[model samples]
Target: MINAKKLEEIAKQVSESLPPSVKQFAEDMEGKTKQILQSKLSQLDMVSREEFDVQTRVLMRTREKLVDLEQKVAALEASINQQQPESNE
Candidate 1:
């Protein structure tokens, strides 16, 4: 059976091997580095590639529809004009 004193001795040895200050400094450095990277990235005006692709597709579709509507309106106007007879009095 493993007694409490042996467990306490093992724990004491583990804690003694590493000083608390060094452990805290390592954690602090990691946090600061993460914050710096995040701040620098946020300053840039950049969209994800997916977002840019979506916008490009939407614009192309809109342009194509507009052109089709314009052609349809022009064709309708032409037909209406042709149906009306010109009278020379």
Candidate 2:
């Protein structure tokens, strides 16, 4: 989700940019702008930096486990092959 404080700051900046004639409506405009910004941002698929980093760490751990499992399987196969008798026997 987008940060509410940042969204409010952006809305305030927009409101402050209006002409004197529209100054009376600045508060209302700020509220509307905040709603619009939040709605639009929610529609998009996004993740916070922290969330992304957590997922990255999970992927790294999973990859490491996969490599370890592969090596173990290879060793087991080699051992099984060694224990089997020759077909000519």
Top candidate (TM-score): 2
Task: Name the lDDT value of residue 10 in candidate 2.
Answer: 98
Residue clash pairs of candidate 2 = none
- lDDT (Cα) of model 2: 0.94
Q: What are the RMSDs of all candidates, in order?
A: 11.4, 9.8
Quick one: best lDDT, which candidate? 1
Which stretch of 10 consecutive residues in model 1 shows the poorest summed lDDT? 14-23
In candidate 1, what are the lDDT values of residues 1-89, reduced to their tens digit? 98999999998898778789977887899999999999999999999999999999999999999999999999999999999998889
Over 1-89, each residue of candidate 2 has an lDDT whose tens digit, in order, gives: 89999999999998878897788676689999999999999999999999999999999999999999999999999999999986884
Give the TM-score comparing model 1 with the true structure, all chains together.
Answer: 0.47
CA lDDT of each candidate?
0.95, 0.94
C-alpha TM-score for every candidate: 0.47, 0.55
As for candidate 1, its clashing pairs are none
